[model samples]
Target: MKRLAALGWPALGVVTLVLLWVGAALYMGKPHVLPGPWAVAETMFSMRGPLVVAAAKSLSRVGVGWLAAAAVALPAGWAMGAVPALDRELRALLSLLRPIPPFVWLPLLLLWVGIGEPSSWMVCFVAALFPILAHARQGVAETPVALAAAAENLGATGLHLWARVRVPAALPLTFTGLKAGWSLAWMSVVAAELVGADGGLGQLILDSRNLARPDLAMSGMAVLGAVAAVTGGLLGWAERRVAE
Candidate 1:
């Protein structure tokens, strides 16, 4: 019953939203401006093949870019957090870079990579990298010094200390960062695709707009939102497991 209620509320919320949307569309009486839910659903089914391919392409870019960012961020963040001297040296530089929106890099990337897959991947990487790095650093920095000393007294040192003590302690915040980074990566991929891609959900939306099909455009957006929600739910589940 508890589980059912938990699911029930979200389902109810979705139904409410759909009803509101349908009402608004009917009130406006402008299908081009705001497609009804039924129209969007029809568009989704009709464009399933293209939508699937576009989603796949976007997901591939997100996966590769996020992984690359994580690979660099984990160790780099750990080192910076574990070493005050290093942190001090890099903090100013990071502060400068972190505030810059990931899309701002798109133009430079387009020039360098020529509006290709690499540019898209780079944009996603940039979007994801900072949050992951910042969270990782914070996690390591917040590790209790007393715990580290205790581990040391028990003959734990260096890698052993890090693996057994620091890493475990930092797991929660690190996962938080990872989840945030993934969301940013997903958004960045869509933006990148919109700006310069041959095929992607973002491009599909643009194509629909060019062809004056608001229903298809709305359908593409709905699909993107659905995919992101599912992925985010999985990540949240994993985070809960780790916390447990």
Candidate 2:
């Protein structure tokens, strides 16, 4: 009974949304421009194989870029956060570069790397890097001085201090940043693939558009949204589990 009760709101919300969507699609009365849910579902069913492959490609790109971002960000963020002088030195440069939107780099990347997997990877890398670094830096910098002092008194020093005390303390904020960074990476990959890759959900959408199939375009978008939702749900679950 309790388990069923817990599921009530989510089920209700989903049903409400589906109703609203169906209402809108019916009102629009033009399947080409505003494909109904049924039409989109049919399209998705027909193209499941291609859609799954495209999703896998997109996920692979995101994994590559996100991992690279984390590799660069965690250490750099820790260093910047731990050392006031280093933070001051790089903050200005970070300021200058961080404001530039991810897609703005697309043109330069296109020129340098051309439209390919490399361009897509680079775009995802750029998109994921900044948030993780910013969050990580903030997390480390804000680690309580008392906590570090306690660790130092107990014989912890330098890397050990950071590893044992600061990093663990900073986990919450770092996790926040990591989650945000991965989302950015996912979005960037789609944007990159739209113009840069011959495969992936973005390319699927592009092809669907060129082929005058709104249903297929919606199907691609549906898959993208589903993946994002599932990833986010998993992250939330993990975070909650860790907290517990």
Candidate 3:
């Protein structure tokens, strides 16, 4: 009942949005320009086979890239947080790199890695790496110093100190990083794939546009949005679990 109440306003907002969309579609008086919801639904059902395949391809790319980013970032960030000297040396470099948009590196990545899976993966990696590293480093560095001291006093040493004290203490912020990184990776993967992909949501959108099928492009956008929503929800659930 409480959950229903909480969702009421959002449901109302969605209805309001739909009404506006319908009004716009009707007023413009051209189905080709902007199809109504029903038209989009009809189009979607008719092309469900190809749409599903494109969605799966994009999602697989995102998964591969995000997992790679996580594996690299967590250990590196943990190390930077654990050692003050390393942080001092690396902080300047990180600050320099963080502000540059990941897509800016797309050209160089293409040049170096060529237009293939490697290039797509590189874009996602670049998009995800900085956020994860920043968050993980912050999380580990901010673990209560007093608690760490107490652990040390209790004869916790090296890996034992990290395992017993640091990792658990830092998990919430690390989870935050993971979520941010995943979202970034998802978006970047699509953008990268747009230029070079033979099959994926990005390619679907690009191809639809090239074929002058705006409705199909819109459908592809909807599918991508749905995938992001589901992925984000799962990440949120994971965050809650770790925080708890």
Per-model C-alpha RMSD:
1.3, 1.8, 1.3
Mark the regions of model 1 whose C-alpha exceeds 4 Å error after superposition. Answer: none
Against the correct fold, how does model 2 do in TM-score?
A: 0.93
Query: By the TM-score metric, which is better: model 1 or model 3?
Result: 1
Residues 35-84 of candidate 3: C-alpha lDDT, one tens digit per residue: 88888888799999999999998888888888898999999999999899
Candidate whose TM-score is highest? 1
Clashing pairs in 3: none
Q: Global lDDT of each model?
A: 0.92, 0.91, 0.88
User: What would the TM-scores of all predictions be?
Assistant: 0.96, 0.93, 0.95
Q: Candidate 1: how many backbone clashes?
A: 0
Query: Candidate order by TM-score, highest to lowest?
Result: 1, 3, 2
Cα lDDT tens digits for candidate 1, 28-83: 99998898999999989988999899889988899999999999998899889999
Residue 178, model 2: Cα distance from true site in angstroms: 0.5
**Cα deviation of 179 in candidate 2 (Å)?**
0.4
Error of 2 at 130 (Å): 0.5
> Weakest 10 consecutive residues, lDDT, candidate 2?
235-244
Better candidate by TM-score, 2 or 3: 3
Q: Relative to the unseen true structure, what is the C-alpha lDDT of residue 38 in candidate 2, on a scale of 0 to 100?
A: 92
